[model samples]
Every structure is written in C-alpha cells, then in structure tokens.
Target: MKRKLRSGITASLLAVTACMALHSPQSLAARDAQTILKETCQGCHTPEADNALSRISHQRKTPEGWLMSIARMQTMHGLQISDDDRRTLVKYLADTQGLAPSETDGVRYALERRLNTVEKFDDQTSQMCGRCHSGARVALQRRPAQEWERLVNFHLGQWPSLEYQALSRDRDWFDLARKEMVPLLAKRYPLDNPAWKKWQASAPKAQAFVGDWNFSGHLPGKGELAGVMSVTADGDDTFKVSVKGQYADGSPFNGDGSAILYTGYEWRGNVTIDGVTMRQVFAAQGSAMQGRMFEAEHDERGLDFVAAKQGSSRLLAVQPGYLKAGTETEVTLIGSGLSGKPNFGKGVEVLEVVEQSPDRIKLKLKAAANAQPGLRSVMVGSLKGPTLSVYSTIAEVKVVPAFSVARIGDGGGSTPKVQGRFDAEAWGKGADGKLYRIGVFPAQWKVEPFDDRAREDEDVKFAGTMQADSGVFTPGDAGPNPERKMSTNNAGNLKVIAAVDDSGKSLTGEGQMIVTVQRWNNPPIP
Candidate 1:
C-alpha cells in the first residue's frame, strides 16, 4: 500500500499550518531526550537492545529538520509529546548530531527557502534522484553505500507506486538505484570530511551574530533596496534585529523583528517591513550573510537579500537596476562613503552627476546603441557599488510570478473579487549569451487559459479578468459555481501575457497564474 493515510495527514498538516504550538509555557521545562522519546515515540520508533533509537539515532539533521520529522510522527504515527518536550528533543538531536557548517553550505539555500535556486547534479543522479525531489535534499545527507541502498529500498517499500510514476515507469529505477546510485551517493558524500574535523576541534563556543551590518537586495517588481541592519543577541541562539532602508524611489522603509538560529547557521526571522509583516530566512557565515526575504502572508513574493559586516565602504544598490539601450535614464546609486566621478562599468556613459552625498548619488546615465548588455559592476573612487544591468532591443518580455495563485474574496459584504497583481519586464540577449534584464515596462496585459483543455472550458471568462493597463487580475467571488468542473469554486489555471513595443517590433512573454480557493491559517514559515 502507498500509505494513503499518512499522505492525507501530511497534506492537512502542511495546508493548514506551518508552525504548531502544542505545549504551554509550563510544559516546556527541559527534559531528557531519552525519557521523552521513550514515553511518546518508542511505540513505533522502537529502540534496539543496545538502547539506541532506530532510524532516529542513525540520522542527523538541523533543528528544523528534526522538527519536521517529529511533526510527521505526531500527525501520522500518533506520537504525542508536549511542545516543550518536542523542542527539547529537537535541540538534543541537532546539537549532538547535526551536520557541520561546511557540510551545510550547499543545501543552506534550501533551508533558507530561497526561490528559483538551481540544484546541480550529474545526469544520472538528476534522472535517478532529482526526478522526485530537489538534489539539495540529497546533498544534505551523509551515509554509507549500504545505508543509501537501504534508503532506496525504504522509498520503494513505503510507496509501492513509485515504479509506476512518470520518472521511473520506463526505467529500471530499482535495479539502477541499487547498483549505481548507492555507490555514487556514498562516495560523493562521505560521513567524515577534513573540514568537519578541523571545525569540530576549534569551533567557537557561541557563534551568535551581534553587530551592525550593511545589506542590499532586489525585490522583484519593486526595484532595488539598500539598508543597514542591527542584530543583538536576545537569547542563547535568538536575536533581535532592526532594519532601516529605502526603496529605489527613495521611500523610507523600516522593519523590526526577532530571529532564532537553528544548527548555528540558519537564521529565521519574523518581521514587519514597510508596515507589512514579512519573514526573513538568512544564513550567517562569519562576517557575511545572504538569504531571502518575503511577505509573511504570501511567500510567492520574495527577493534576494545580502549583507556584509558594517563599517566597510561599498556600493549597496542601483535604482531601476537597468538601462534601456540608447535611452537616457537617471540612476541613483545608494551606498556609503561615495566620492569622485563614478565609473559606470563598461558600455555605459555618464552625462552628469546630478547630485552627490556620502550615501546617495544621482546621475544621468546612458548606454550607447551598440553598448554591451548585462549586469556590470559599478565603482566610484575606492568604493564599489552594486551592479547595473543594460539591454538593447527587447528580445523578450516575461510576466513575473510565472506560476501564481489567488483566492476569491469572501462574499459576506466584502468585495466580490480578489485582485492579483502582475508585473512584466523586458529582456535582451547579451554578448555573453545570457539574458540581460531591461526592467519593468508598461505593457498590454491579457489572460488566457494555460492550455487547450482550459480554453475549451472557458476558464478565462469565468474565473477572472486581466486589467489591461495595470496587469492585475480580479478573480470572481468564491462559491460553488455550476459552470466549473465538479461545481467547485471559480478557480482556473491561466497564462498572463505581456506585450511591449521595442522600436518597431512587438515582443511578448507569458507566465502561469492560478486562481484558487482561500487558505486558512496561513503561517509565516510555509
């Protein structure tokens, strides 16, 4: 059997809430890991005669990893433990058995919840392993060949329908995994590495981040933002963080939050930015940090964030971030200690420095008709700034939130339709054969069914309408609609298309959007 009950329970768990508070403050007093596991988990996670736990003892993971595992046990296997006990057990396992810092470097992106991260794997591994989940999930582990082989067996045994899935149906998945994959994975990720040994011998007693840092990031559709952050230790591994920054438009933005570091490197924070709550997932390594920041409510909207130790002079951000070929555009450079005439990297010409300050510089910058396109470094005197992108003819236009979801508004005197926004950007191929961004541009917006089946079902007409000038979709109200399949809510899978005029040519790009039902109990970490 495929363990349908577990699958349904997991779906419910994930769909409903990302964080579960199952214990009161009084119940969270520290307890021995052995006692808690024996009382709540031993019924299924039976200990061997050696007094060692079965699968739990063999595996090592970050606190978040252990939390997910325990949550699965609670939901699927009927394990029961107070919230305090669960927290205590997770800490015990992570502190004693977590991967070293170096071991976590590759998969930190996964833990940080960064969007659009590409996982690298060889062709064999990609087909054999990544066909189901991320390759980073594989890279995050260390095991012997025998153990890897057994894990493959576990997958097949737990989900007997694996062999019938699209990726495995036509291939000898079981045989190849047993023979080729086991050895490849074992050799690739041996348990003992020299770096880990060195780190363990001299690892600092505490590696809490407690200082001011400078940060810069790009928010898709919102342009570039630069800021300074102050972090102070709030607990052994928790922090209080404050941020002060501005968007490219010079609008002041400020945020305050708290964070908890799990496994020493993973920093997860809940904060409010620009009057809206947001979550931050960043990794700290020595004097540098980088990660993703997104809305606490809707994770689909996120951006890249990076920071370096404070007190250094560097370029932090470039407003608009890109220049259209042969067009004169005003650019703002946000940074610290900026001086002298700025160099606009290659293929860019500065007409005049409009204004100057230690932290802000505005200039009229232009790219020649034949200028090279792509991200180029910015420099002013000894201070280096963020990158600027340039592009010529609009080779393409892509709508962001490529795959989007929106829910209809509740009909109890509320607006009849929920609005979803979209932004379109133009892009051009650079000399290096890579696509260079041309930034957002005004475009004609339209919506259509994602496929022929959706088109025949008239989804675009019943589900929503795309506001041509603004690129926003207003979805129909929620209810059982007899027009839709199964008489469900007015939901749809749609393609948002953007068309822009470049010189005399018209270019178009499309992205996926889905209008669905409302989500209850949306959690910050989901």
Candidate 2:
C-alpha cells in the first residue's frame, strides 16, 4: 500500500494558546510544575509511594507526547485546564519525566514533521499498533509492562473497531496485544533505563541558548542560506529569537520569533521573514544545534537548518557549494573563525579572495577539467570542515524523495492544501568506485500517470499542476470534479518526473506522489 506522509488531527485535539502573560508575574511564578500538577492532576491520578502520580509517573515521553496526553485528558476525561496551566504542565513533565537525548536520536523525524519517513518496526508492533499510527509514536515513550498492558486495553476500549481491522480480524487481537505486545514493548523500552536517570539529574537549564549562533540551511525552492541567530530569555523556558542572514543570491533573510526550550535540548521557534511565518525544530547540545525549520502552515516547504554558537570556530558550509569541473565560479564559505590561507582540495584553484571575515570567507575558484569527481574537503587556516562537490558530468539524477503525498484542500475550507515539494539530487561515481552525492541541482518538473488506471482516469489532467523550474507540485482543489468520471474528488496517483541538463547531457529521475483527500486528524505529533 502507498504511504501518505501528510496526515491531520481532528478538531477535537487540545488547543494550546499563544505564549504571553496570561497571569500576573507573581501568580505565574507561584504556579511551578509541582503546584500545577497537584492542583490539576491529583484528583484523577492517585499518589504513589515515592510521591509520583499514577500513569504519568511510570512513563517518560517527549514534549509533544505530554501535550497529547493533556489533550486526551481534556477530550476524554473532562479535564478542564487553562492553556497557561497546560503549557506549564507539559514543560514540567517533559523536563523531569522526558526521554533521554539518546532515546530520541533516531525518532527526531516525527518531531521535526518529516512526515514522509517510512517507518520500520518488528512485525508484532507494526501490525498491532503502527498499522493505524506511527511506530515512532510507540517507540517515543518508555513504559513498564503494566502501563503497556493498560495502554493496549485503552486502545481496544476507546476504538472498539480494533478487532474488526484487516490484520486484527484474522487472529485473537486482544490476546496477542496483551500476551505478545506488552512484553515486547516493556523489554524494548523499559521505564528504568539508565539514560533517563542520568539526563534527569544533569540536564542543562533552558538558558543555555541565551547567546549568538551561526546557522546554515537549504530550502527546496529557495536556494542555500547562512546566517546568525540571536537568542534571549523571555520567560521561564521561553525565549525571544532573532535571525539575520541572507540567501545564496544575496537576498536578505531576516526574522524574529519567540521560542520555548523543552526537555533541555528541544528548541521550538516561530519566526517570520518577509511576512512568511516559519517554525524551527532544533536540538541544542552545548554550542551546536541542528534541525529542520519549516513554514508552520505549509510544512512541506522547509529548510534543513544547522547552527553553532558564535564561540565555535568550526567551518559550517559552502554556499553555492558546487562547481563544474571545467568552470570558474564564486562561492562563500560560511563558518566561525575563518582565517589563514584558504584551500579547496586538489582539482580546485583559488584564483582570488572575494571577501574575508571572521564568520565568512568568499573566494573565486576554478576546478580543473580533469578534476577527479567527488566531494572535496574545504579548509580555512588550520581548522578543517565542510565539503563541496567537483564533477565534470552528471552521472545520474535521482529525485530527493522517491515517494510522498500531497493533499487536496483550500477549496473554501478550514484545511489548506498540502503541496508536494521535490529536489533533483545529482550523483557521480568517484575514482574509488563509490557513488558520491554532488548536490541538489536545477530541474524541469512534470507529472504523468502512475499506472494504467491513472492513465484511463486522466489523473494527470485532473490531479494537479507541477511547476517546471521550481519542482513544486500543487494539487487540485477539493470536492468532486464534474469533468472526472463519477464526478470524483480531485485525488489520483501520479508519477513525478524531473529532467536535468548537466552541461549538454540530459538526465532524468522519477518519484511517486499520491494527491489525496483532506486529513482532519492533524496533530502536533503526527
């Protein structure tokens, strides 16, 4: 079955309000994690022997997981809590009872809204739970066997259709869930892991991000970018962030937004640049931070952002980071503490230094026509970091995402249309006989029918429009189309194709896109 990346939550999920002073300074300060927990949760959650509350005490989760829990409380348990109090509870629970950084390493895709990720899991877990939601969703939490069993019960009790689903109907779903899944989940992700204990005892304070930072990223439609971000403390775990930089084309990239640090390292920021609102989901560790930042509304359009604090002298990236083996071009090295002589490895010659700075170094360079095609390490002074590709010919062009999903909406409705973004990644075989990724290159985009059914149904004409130069696929409007047979909604299977011209040679890559209906169940996690 084709996997649809973008899904939605129902309107019934919890609503978290914007961050602001909803109460007096004294009142807010008085309502710490413990105080709010006692007043809000003590009614339903029984106190344990060690002063821990039931259910919540036995599990560890990310900030989003906790938020979902509170949202569920409001929807299913008649728990009426203010937005301010809910936010406080989420922070407190996440910080004190959250997963360790190591625990969240591989699952950051779910948090970053890289919704296109194809999940892999053991058969029992995948078929039993992940068939409906993400396996990452289950892997994100650490729970005891008892809690896992309780969760299984909750699933069957809440959604009584559990036994009627395709895979579930073939067997004793409840027996397998309790007997097989409970033990598997418990052993795989135990509540008493040592990483959690260590993290809880030594996690850094939220103020760690109060300083200047060097950042670099790439947005699909908008070229490469590098800049500096300044952060300041706003409230308890909240921050005020400002970014100043420019795209590779010298276009200014400036914005300011508020941020909230959850579980010490999770950095969530909302900034607006040139009137476009963007959100940052980064992990801060000491002086370095990295993550993806996307437009809050249209998440498909985003940048893979990486940043280092101002103090580090590490080389971050090379803007316009590629050069044709026989061509001369100007490229900027964006980093910290760039000095001394500059080098671009073997085949590249530094003709002149266009600009130099402590944070940036611009140089005019040329690659020999006989340059061995591969990624060349860039160096500035003694510090060695960052790499740019040198290739004479495009060996192959592969669409970045081999498969994805786009939604049909914005036809006078609450849910907006989800666009399908694509990038053409060029690769070359080096002298050592390894396929090295050159980088994202310009391409002409088009769509065709995926199968004979799609062709017979005229899906290409009715599904959507693919931008030629930008590779942006915007799906058609929602509701039934009178022109299509049966007047069906504008949903169809499409073959996304990209044509690239390297020098004079043409290369093409193809991917799959499912333009489908609206998903009303969008939530913070999914």
Candidate 3:
C-alpha cells in the first residue's frame, strides 16, 4: 500500500511538471525544477519498497521555506546538491507547491521582517505551539489531523529529549498536544482550502501587471524613501525592473535589476537601494503592493516598502519623528500634498512654521512636560503624517539587546567596540490590574557582572570597559595571558546596566554581553 502511495505521489509531481513544460519549454530544457527534484530529493523522500513520501508530498511552502528544508536535510541526512541544483529545486517547489496569498496573510509581518511585531495567539496555542517556536512558523503551514499527529510523532522520534526540555516538561505535553492541540491545528489550518484551489487552477501572467509603480518606504534610524519602479516583461516568469528615489537626507537612491514573480503574488527582486545591493520581497495583490527592500547581504538595514497603482497624494512621512519630552526641535515632513494650518497632536505644540512647500514642511515644536511616551498621530489639513514616537519619563531602562555575543581579535589598532543602545520604557500598572507598556523613554549607562561567576571574571577589569556616556564596550586585545581561564584570550561575560533617574523617578535595567573568541569568516552576510 505504501509503495503504491509513493509511486502515485511521484507520478503526480511529474505530471504537474509535464503540464508546466507545455508553457515553459525553455524552463524545462534549462535548469528544470522537476528534473532537479527527481535527481536529488526522491531518495529519502520517496519509498524504498513499502514507505511513502507522505511528508514531502502533502505540504507546500515558500521558496525560502523550501531552502530551509533543504538545508535541514543537508545538516541531518548529509544530503548533497550543487548550488545551481539547490536553487532550481527550491524555485520549482515554491512555484508549484507554495502557499496561497490568503494563507500567508497572518504571517506577512514575519516575511516583511518587522521587528517586535507580536503574533496573536490564544493561551492554549501560545503554550502548545508558540512556546518552542514563533507563531508565524506554526501559522505558515496547512495539515490534516493525521499529518499533524505524524508531525508530533516525528518530533518525539527525532528528538527523544523534547519532553525533558524546559518548556515542554511543565506538563504532560505529548498527551495534551495529542488530545487538544492537534485537533485545534487541524481545524484551523486544514490541508484543503478554496484559496489554494483557485491558485492551482490557473497561473496569472506577470505581463498583465507590468508597469510603472509608485512606492514609498521608511527605515527606522535610517530615513524615509519615495520612488518609482518601472517593470517590464523579461520572460514568461521574469521581469526587468528599475527604481529611482531619494532618501530624506536628499541622497540619491536608485537601482536597475530583474525579478521573478512566483506564486502569482510573490515578487522577488535583486536591486540596489541607496547604492547598496538589496533583495525585494513584495506581495502584489491587484494594483496595490507592500513588502520590504533589505540588504541582500544582511537582512537587517532594510525599509518598509509600500506602493500603489496610482500616483502618491497626501502621503506624508516625518523625519526624526520624535522629540525629547518637554524639549524643542525642528521637524521635517515630506509628502506630495500640503495646505493650511498644521495640527501637531496632543502633548505637543508647534512654536513656529519654519518652512512650507507642496513636498516639504518644517516646524519648531515643543513637547509638553506630561507628554505621552508613545506614538501620536500628526496631521496637516486632511493629510496625515507618519505617527511620531515620544519619550519623557523613564520608568524602566533596558539594553536594546537583552543579551549579545561579541568576538575578540580586532587586528590591533584601538580595537573595535560593540556600540550598544539603551531604551527607557514607560512601565506602570494599568487600571486593568496588569503591567502594560507605555512606550520608549530616555536613560544613562553602566556595566557590572551578570552573576556570581561573572563577578569572579577578571575580564570586567582587564578585558574591557564600557563608556559612561555611550553604552559601547571597548574590549582589550586578544591574549594568551595568565589572567583568564587556561590563560586564554581576554574573554568573559558581563552585564550592561542602563539607569534612568528623571523627573523624580528612578529605574534601571541590565543585559548580558558575552565577549568570546575570534570570528575568522566575517562575511558580508554575517
């Protein structure tokens, strides 16, 4: 029975490729996705004699998701494939068996790489699904009850000590998951869906959507961007794209590149933003588009990209959109439309309108002493600007990264330091009898040992020192001295402490910093 099932599955995959070959004959002849899959994936995925390719056949995922699976296989099963072949397989699988647009709606924030965006999950779901991995990971899949059951078994079979892990050991995890979580998952995300049915029925032509697209974006701590992207058909599945724009600082931001629109709506492109190579992950649904443009080398340093079929109007972005509570500063607002008097929301007041134009506006503003430490809406006539973040009283101080790992060996000179930032949050008891976040506030800096063992570590004294003004840590040279354990490098773990004593309130927070060995391959990606 299992042999028959595996044979049928292999035939189904081949049949799907055969249908695609009728339209993309060149694709089949050159780097055929299905050909790569048959050669590399069928061994373990397919049956020997009585085993089925159940897991492989029954699921779908994104291109990056498939790449992760391939990477996992290489790590665990020693699966080997050339880079070219890997790319071919990933592209093919994603094109033929990827999630529908509606299916990915819940996890779009994860794909867009938004920071600190929390996923909503019920108490049971949080405990059962979100405890080990992110909610997005769980939301990205569709499985039947039996498949979900097999997945639980696969977890136990692969990692026998799973139940003994800290989070899993709190209760009878296996029993609860079997009786409760499994049913919930099966009901919420079943294998069959109307969205997938519609998507698989017909493939949309990318040429129909090719045109000049107007876009706007913003990267926190960087600046805002407004641009135009001209897209033309390159092939049946590919496009040639060019972009031109400017940052808020007036620096030229432009690029020319190509893209592949897979899964109908996933527009994956390689382009340059502000002279830096970046990858564009856009979801094109009808005339509207939204996604991200991130450094291809390092996914961090990216911006939120949103575009529309029509020209931008009344869209405003305020640069450095925040002020120290009760302090005064100049604020710049950029957009395509402007008029009459401006309204600087509550807790803030405009002292003077420094400048005004259709595309720009500048104002000197002062924040009230009792200003709210959170985002506030900014409005000018009917045009709404990007919400501004305000900081005043610091009820709590926290090192941005709760913990970090920095390496030794800086190749002489003054030796590089890790520039850490501190954040003050308005933490207080709410009327609902719970502690809720009020937002970011202001703070000061210091350092100490994280624990008793850290206290004994001489690295705090001899290894490095933290700047009082800036939270940056300057480590001493790598060594083979008699100070540390085994006379190794000046490596140790310490705590970064941030303090805030403002407006008659005192608060403090600490984070762990691990100073360790040298990193040889400091690649651009890292």
Strongest candidate by TM-score:
2
The local distance difference test score of each candidate is 0.71, 0.83, 0.66
Model 2 scores a C-alpha lDDT of 0.83
Please list the Cα RMSD from the true structure of every candidate, rounded to 1 decimal place. 5.2, 3.7, 9.0
Candidate 2: tens digits of C-alpha lDDT, residues 200-319: 788788777788898899988678999999999888777788999888778998998888888888777788877898878888888789999888778788889988788778788887
Number of colliding residue pairs in model 3: 1
Q: Sort by TM-score, best first: what order?
A: 2, 1, 3
Expressed as tens digits, the lDDT of each residue in 104-162 for candidate 3 is 98687666654335568898888777766667776777778898898888778877888
Score candidate 2 by TM-score against the native: 0.94
Per-residue error at 244 for model 2, in Å? Answer: 1.5
Candidate number with the higher TM-score (1 or 3): 1
> How many residue pairs clash (N, CA or C atoms closer than 3 angstroms) in each of the candidate models, in the order given?
2, 6, 1
Can you rank all candidates by lDDT, best first?
2, 1, 3
RMSD of 1: 5.2
Worst 10 residues of 1 by lDDT: 18-27
Backbone steric clashes in candidate 1, count: 2
